[model samples]
Target: MASIPPAMAPSTANWHWKNKNVTTWAKTWFERELPTISVQDDGNEVSVSEVVDVDGDVELGQRKSKYVPPMY
Candidate 1:
């Protein structure tokens, strides 16, 4: 469905990804919230400083079409 000149389109056949230090979106939250997530003694011991529970609600509905077909 796209109409464009071939010369203007960027070629991805020879594209090479570069290694860069990209920051993660959840890195800050993990460090601040789950700093105590670790194991000890051959992964036999575990600890958690805090725990959080989330709750939510959702509603569903249907509406009739506003358009009416013209009477022939």
Candidate 2:
């Protein structure tokens, strides 16, 4: 009788979601949409907000953004 080899784990290096590779599309969309995003504070008169910091783990789908209101 012949012995079968153990199965290998599936590769997720190029996967974005369930069996689909949407990295390119998602990345492009995120880049385009990022510039249009704005964070505003309702308590104060925040006329404009500038992106002070941006950091996150893309693979984990985690993102953080810090906005600073301009000073007169």
Candidate 3:
């Protein structure tokens, strides 16, 4: 998107041109952009335990829980 004019601040209504059709332009641009990120985790087990009542119940704002390994 182009920068907003200095004298006129940006508002939700006029952020971008509403009538102009830019569907083709957007599709073409994204086709060239490649995603290059990958995530892998070592073989490990994570355990989460409840800290309050084992009955699986707690009042609002009166309950606390934590992960067993504390890293997950």
- List the lowest-lDDT window of 10 residues for candidate 3: 58-67
lDDT tens digits, residues 1-72, model 1? 222212222334324322222123234344456646767896597766654532332222112312222233
TM-score of each: 0.21, 0.33, 0.24
Error of 1 at 8 (Å): 20
Ranked by lDDT, the better of candidates 2 and 3 is 2
Highest TM-score against the true fold, candidate: 2
List the lowest-lDDT window of 10 residues for candidate 1. 58-67
**Comparison by lDDT, 1 against 3, better one:** 1
Q: Which portions of model 2 miss their true places by more than 4 Å?
A: 1-18, 42-72
Q: What value of lDDT does candidate 1 attain over all alpha carbons?
A: 0.36
Which lDDT tens digits does candidate 2 get at residues 30-64?
A: 55555665566866443323434444422222112
Task: Assess the local accuracy of residue 58 in candidate 3 as a C-alpha lDDT between 0 and 100.
Answer: 18
In order, candidate lDDTs are: 0.36, 0.38, 0.31
The residue pairs found clashing in candidate 1 are none
lDDT of 3 by residue, 15-69 (tens): 3432323344444333333222234569654443322312222111111221122
